[model samples]
Target: MNKKKPITPFGWAIKQRLTELQMDQKSFCELHGIPPSRLSNLIHGTRKAARYRQLVAKLLDIHLTEEK
Candidate 1:
């Protein structure tokens, strides 16, 4: 039997775009209204949630970018 581990799709996606934009955690948090500490945790993979990351994605316009 095989069990698959859960994935943090939103967090992973955000991290990717941030890297692409050459953005640091502080700047990204400031731009997105995310608490610095919380953003740090999320980016470091210490946190996981669909709703929060979805909001982050939307706020950062990642969803729109993905559509293009």
Candidate 2:
């Protein structure tokens, strides 16, 4: 049906960690040398690039948990 999907555990983790650090996604992307668009895609689970996923997780030091 092409319904919008929920944010993944990894995505939520990234956002949560960013919020904890009091940083915005744009700033986090810029600071980490990641394109904002790519980060968005990564969070939305559209970007399936393993390398980028690993880089983001490592850089953010995030542990993923699905919130309900």
How many steric overlaps does candidate 1 have? 0
RMSD of 1: 6.7
Those runs of model 2 whose alpha carbons end farther than 4 Å from true positions after fitting are 1-4, 63-68
lDDT per residue for candidate 2 within 1-68, as digits (tens), equals 87656787788888998999999999988898888878887788876756677788888896544333
Tens digits of lDDT, candidate 1, 1-68 = 74533334555777788788899768977886778866655555566544555677676677623220
The backbone clash count of each candidate, in order, is: 0, 0
Q: Which lDDT value does model 2 have at 45?
A: 83
Top of the candidates by TM-score: 2
Query: Which candidate leads the pack in lDDT?
Result: 2
The lDDT of each candidate is: 0.63, 0.80
Listed in order, each prediction's TM-score against the native is 0.51, 0.79
**Model 2 residue 39 lDDT score:** 84
